[model samples]
Target: RLIQRAKRFWPAFVVAGLANALFGLLDAGFVMLLEPLVSKGLVGRDPETLARAPVFVIVIVALRGVAAFVSGYTMAWIGQKVVAEFRCQVFSKLLRLPAEFFDRESSGNLLAKITYNADKIARTSSSALTILLRESAFLISGLIYMLYTNWRLTLFFFISFPAIAAVVRVATRRFKKASHNMQDAMGTMTALGSESLQGYQTIRIFGAEAQAEENFKKTVERFRRKFMSMIATQNLSTPLIQLLAATGLALVLYVSLSELQSGRLTEGEFIAMVSLMMASLRPLKQLSSVNSQLSEGLVAAQSLFDILDEPEERDSGTVDLPTLSGEVVMENVTYCYGENSPALIDVSFSVKPGQLVAIVGPSGAGKSTLLNLLMRFYHPTKGRILLDGHDLESLTLSCIRRNMSLVSQTVTLFNDTIRNNVCFGLKEVPSDEKIIEVLKQAHAWHFVKELPGQLDAMVGEGGSNLSGGQRQRLAIARALLHNTPILLLDEATSALDTESERHIQAALDALMTDRTTFVVAHRLSTIQHADMILVLEGGRLVEQGTHQSLLAKGGVYSRLYRLQFGEPQLGTTTS
Candidate 1:
């Protein structure tokens, strides 16, 4: 995937590789120049050689510097661009992924993949590749020079090559394993830190600071241990490889010195050979170090690819309804999470246009599950849902969602101006007048007006600057601004005090006046005026009627209402 993304920058990479090769050639040329400068200028006392050599050396050095800069800059550019594209693809995939995927994965791990892993990939794709190529060129050119000067000595110098290869191969396997473990450990550390930071208030209120700190410390320690192992492998391999090179150097020196005493090798040739051998050692050491970085990059790339390959949410519906008539019906719908028992069992209900329907049930009685199915966050395990007399499966998901607005107990707000949060995702930006009107209708304009910049004030992360009731009211205002034909509320006012709830409820009454609204609330009194109410127990719909009618029937709804309101006297009317 990285290579595919880098296609547009291939020319740049090619130029970089050629430039690096040229740099290596210059290195070798410097070694070759030493022989002529020493023999002709110093030993032979040639004035012409002395005068020309300095200019030749200066020109070669200047060209090499330019090549080095171009090679480094181009490789860095390609690496950054490739990783940027990869990160974008990952983020886009996250947006398209099904809700179930998120349910099983941690946000911190996903974040690490986008940030930490991407940087590792950049190092591998650019810096590691540059070092590998440049060093390989240097080593190859140095060897060719050695062979030209003295093949017998060059052949002896390669005796340690096989042993060095064996050591590197073993070290490569260890480095890869360590890299994988470190990546996993880092993800765990990120998850621990994210959880603690996000829930710091809860920790403080509950006096669980020590527990949180301990958990975070454990995760960090694990990451540190893994990181140290990786460092050890990386540090050990370089010196070990260098030691093998040193052995080869010692043998070459021993042979060259003998040849020098026998008059078979000139002083200039001997020095040139030694200088080339020493120059090659640095590149050899760098190549060994790069193996660890390459391993880290490969591990990160694999993790990112796993996310990119995940299947996106299925959207098979072809019909695109321009508008919905606000009628909703569920027929024998059943759903189960995984292999667990069904969350909703043979449940069914219907609402006509402009009707107010309330769903009241105990925890785990499928109140929220019903809403999820309606929103198409999950498909029914059996039967189907219909909107405006058409199966919901027949209409595009976007069309179905666009016609409905949701206000839940937990509201999400970005760190942006209040206006943007209220008008979030709208095709056309809402005017100031329209924004204020919705806020007024939702009973939020009073507080919003008192804020520093009114509608333009920043809300801070997750609307942390606002009180819970204020945030809830802002969410309702957002929903009202959507002006969808259907409204779904999941305990929209449950988190507020009685006074706040009453004020917000009044605004909701107006908002629901002309829309089909489905509400799930635990507060029995809140739904007494609903046009129709459905009572659920243990995933089954036990009763359906107007609140007064259900009370007259003396079924599950009556028992629940009696429990909340206290048992009615035998002679007194339940209502």
Candidate 2:
């Protein structure tokens, strides 16, 4: 996948590498010229050659400098594009993932893949690989020149090969292991930091600031330790490589001295061979350390690819539904998250096209799960759900959702103007007059009109600048504008005062007049007027009836109602 993506930039990548290679070739080629220059220009004092020596030196340096500049600049540009493309892939994959994936993975860890892990690929593509390619080329070219100068002497250069390989093998393993640990710690740190920042107000109110700080410090410490481990491996390998190179040089020196005494090697030739040997050793040292960067990048790439490889939410249904009639039915529908116990069990019910159904339950009784199922966020583990007599799975997911509107307890608003937030996800936005009419219908236009920019007012991050009631009203305005046949209201009125709630409820009642509305009610009083109330307890539908009938039956619904309203006992003493 990486190769396929990078193929578009193949010309630039190759040019960058060729620039580096030219520098390496020139570097080795210069050492080869040292012998002839010293022998003819200096020793024999050849006039023309001596006079042009300065020009030759300048030209060689200039070419190498130009090559280095082009290689560095071009590689950097390619690195930016690579990072950008990978981040885009990660983000696009996220949009297609199933709700279950979000249930298991935190937003922070996912963001780390884009912000932290993707950068390692950039460093690998530009810098780490740069050293790997350039240094290898330099080492190969230098070795070739030495062999040409004195084949017998160059053979001794291999005396330390086995030792050098051993050091590199050990260091590579250490680097890879340490880098993996560091990345894991980095992800944890990012998750913890995001969690802390988002809930800082709650943490402070509960006097848990010290606890939060300690937890953050621990993650940061773990990240530091892992980073140090990678650094230690890199630091330790350098001296070991230098010592091996020196051993090889000592053996080569001994062979060279013998060859010189036997009159087989000239002084100029001997000097050139030693110069190439030193030049070769520097690149060899750089090559050894470059593995650390490569190992780190390898670990990051694997993490990113793991996300890319995950199958998107199953959309096997070929049905492309048009507008729905809002009729809904569930026949023994059950849902379980992974291997856990079912959150909804054998839940069977049916609602008319324009009926208001209230789902009342304790905190974990799967009240929200019903809405989640209707929204096709998850499919039933068993049984089936039907919309307008068509299987839920048969209808396209987007088409099924288009017929519904949701306003949850926590209203979601982007950092955009009021107009955009109200008309979000609509391919073609409604006109300003239409938006204003909807806002008034939601009882939100009063305050919206008072804002400086009115319709163009920025909501700030997650609508933080607005009060909870104002945010909820805006959400209602959005739902009102959508005019979906099915409306799901999950405690949307909780943030408002009694007067505001009454007004919003009146507007909502008008809106739900001919719509299939499901209210996941927290307050029994609010849903008392629902046509049918489904009372749930421990993931089972224990009772179903209207408020007056359920209260008369004296079941779970009656018990919950008496508890909330503190209904006076028929015959009992006060505390």
Candidate 3:
């Protein structure tokens, strides 16, 4: 299958193969030069021919050198091409895979496929291929020369053939098994390393460094064991096969000596024959070593192919969704994660355009899952959701998502300038003046302007250089710039201080005036003025009504509010 795929680059493969073969054939032809030098030049006293031998040797060596260069350079080029192409395919597949797929798989494993496994393919394409083609040519040429010199003696050399074949067959299976184990171990090691680095602060705080170190050491030891196992197999088999072939060479040499004693072979033929056979041993040993590279490449290829074969997210919708008025409706919706109990069950709700619907719930009460459904990240397992009276499933995923902007609790900022982070994924990128106005609206421009580079300052990875409040404010700024019809804020202001939260709430109030907004909040103070609040508990809507009304009822929302504020001051809507 890999070779068939490589046929796409047939021109390069052909050039590299032919050059490698010519190099080996030239080497074999070089050995035959000795026959003439011994018989014709020395014995026959051909002074004229002997005089030109240096030039002949120089020309053959020069052509062989050129062939080696062309072969090595071109094969390396093909290897690089293979790595680039496979990485691109894997990367594209990652972008299209469903969110559930990402949730279940570790990121480190995916990364290894693109980096380490793809590199194995390169080694196979270049060095492994070079050895296979070039050595076979050299070995075949030597075998032919041996036959021409003394067919009877060459017949004895074939006695060790089955043993060499059997050894290679056993070694190949072991090599492949070791390669698979090594690749999987490498992925686990990568995952462990990434986790330790990313969670370094927590590790230090908890003083669990020893535990982390112990776990990493175990994984490293596993990887090393598999590596050494492969090496031991390769080393043991190479010499054993060499010894077997040497036995055949010994048998052939004994026969040749007897033939020489009987005057059946010339002195020049014997010398040329010995040199070619000795030369043949080198390529044969190298060929045995090629199995390791080929095995690794094969295992890596299967790993990459598995990723490529996974089905992409199902996007069967074709209908166009017009600019939404943000009226969202869910009827008997149910969702479950894998085989677990449904997160949201038979839930139904409707909110008109421009309504600030706050979904308040306990930790596992499925508040975030509601927002996830709204964003079309995961389809409801058993029910339908509609936006502006249009069934969400009938609309393209892009169309459904384009009308909403999300600011989740965990902010994600790129390692780029603040301006780029603020305007991320906006179809119509706002100008500097507009961006500043949006940042000012979200109350983030104050800190941004005080920074060294202001709007152009680098955020660093995940906005690590910024404070938690500043990151939240920047995310709000980005959502404001998005300027979509429907806004989803999952604890968007959770990181802000009381004073900062007040300021951001004022900004959000202004931004939410004409758009439909959903706020999933635990802070009862923030949602006091929400036009309608849906109180969810145990994945069911236990209560739903205006904030003042729900508070007056003294139900779940009322209890939650009193728990935070210590009392429900119902008449005045104050944060």
Best by lDDT: 3
Candidate 2, residue 335: the lDDT equals 94
Q: Candidate 2 lDDT, tens digit per residue, 1-575?
A: 56676779989989998999988888887887888777787777788878887888899999999999999998888888988989998899999999999999988888898889999989988898778778877888888777877888888987898988999999999999999999999999999999999999999999999999999999999999999999999988987888888888888888889898998888778888888887777887788778898899888988999999999988877787779889999999999999999999999999999999999989999999999999998999999999999999999888888899999999999999999999998999989999999999888999999998999999999999899999999999999999999999999898999999999999999999989999998899899999999998888888998999998888888888887888864456777
171-282: candidate 1 lDDT, tens digit per residue? 9999989999999988888888998999999999999999998999899999999999999988888899888988998899988888888887778877888888888788
After superposition, candidate 1 runs with Cα above 4 Å error: 261-264, 566-575
TM-score of each: 0.95, 0.97, 0.95
Q: How many residue pairs clash in each candidate?
A: 0, 0, 0
- Report the alpha-carbon TM-score of model 2 versus the true structure: 0.97
* Candidate 2 wrongly placed segments (more than 4 Å): 569-575
**Residue 188 in model 3: shift from native, Å?**
0.5
Name the weakest run of 10 consecutive residues (lDDT summed) in model 2. Answer: 566-575
Residue 451's C-alpha lDDT in candidate 3? 93
Best by TM-score: 2
Is candidate 2 or 3 superior in TM-score?
Answer: 2
CA lDDT of each candidate? 0.89, 0.90, 0.91
